[model samples]
Target: MKFCLKHGRCNCVEFYQGDLAAQADAPYILEADYKTWLDVIAGKLQPIPAMVLGKIKVKKGSFSVLAQYVTASLAMIKAAQKVGIQ
Candidate 1:
């Protein structure tokens, strides 16, 4: 995921099978403002809904291909929740 913190400055975080890395070139990139990401991570927003609403944008890969990983995506969110965010 590439988070657009502000302006055009962005940071990328990569996740693979529930593991996370500080940076990596992922096949699929999801881009959105920092606040939008916060909302999603905080469980205030659903990723799919956010994407549909345009709060999130796909910067790389195809949506159809990404959709195949919905389960993994949700699992990532769940794991993040378990780790908590501060």
Candidate 2:
């Protein structure tokens, strides 16, 4: 899945879910283990806090760039929770 989040605006964000091979490219990609991702989508963990605990890693892009989208990032998490992953 690919989620495009704009600054402080969750409503305008774009999300896509499908085969990995068909997914669109994103400049920044947040990487975590399957369990960690599930925990996040289930609202059992928070991304930033997880990163602080070394549970999540930014496999692409810089921290500074990702930091600029914190609000949108959280918004993405909230949206993911609603997807009924659990």
Candidate 3:
């Protein structure tokens, strides 16, 4: 059941948490919306620990490649925050 903050409307939804089968009777939600919600819940807990922090030897190149990972991570964080997650 989904609770509508506007009014005391408690939607008796058949969905359980994030189950698709339960959401079958619910309205169609966008994929982006789902992803953000998941990320927020995940963020509330501890981050993933690195199994191994071995720095692999890389070929001689500029350090710009590291920038790509940083940018993508920031974008993901922003998108997650856009949703009601934290």
Candidate 4:
């Protein structure tokens, strides 16, 4: 999971996918609620590890939830490649 999140993150993907409509970076986040994001972060969801618990706080909108995941995925991928998680 970690590997898929942050592999070669520098150019593999946009670290900041700023949204044009929102005019803010890290846009393209997710479409989930705060609790949903929390659940994913708190090990209440599958395909995710318990380590992500509470590392980040949920926001008022979907962007907040999605951004964390996007950024996390990038990091995970990087870490995976870093440590040869494969």
Would you list the C-alpha lDDT of every candidate in the order shown? 0.67, 0.67, 0.35, 0.39
Q: Model 3 Cα displacement at 78 (Å)?
A: 0.2
Model 4: residues with Cα > 4 Å off, grouped in runs: 1-21, 47-86
TM-score of each predicted structure versus truth = 0.67, 0.65, 0.23, 0.29
- Model 3 lDDT-worst window of ten: 45-54
Worst 10 residues of 4 by lDDT: 1-10
lDDT of 3 by residue, 1-86 (tens): 22222233333433344445345433322222444345434554211111012121212233345334444434544544566543
Backbone clash pairs for candidate 3 read none
Sliding window of 10 residues with minimal summed lDDT for model 2: 13-22
Q: Using TM-score as the measure, which candidate wins?
A: 1
Misplaced by over 4 Å in model 3 are 1-68
Candidate 4 lDDT by residue in tens digits, 17-55:
223324333423333444554454444553233223543
RMSD (Å) per prediction:
10.1, 4.0, 14.5, 10.2
Q: Model 1 Cα displacement at 1 (Å)? A: 4.4
lDDT of 2: 0.67
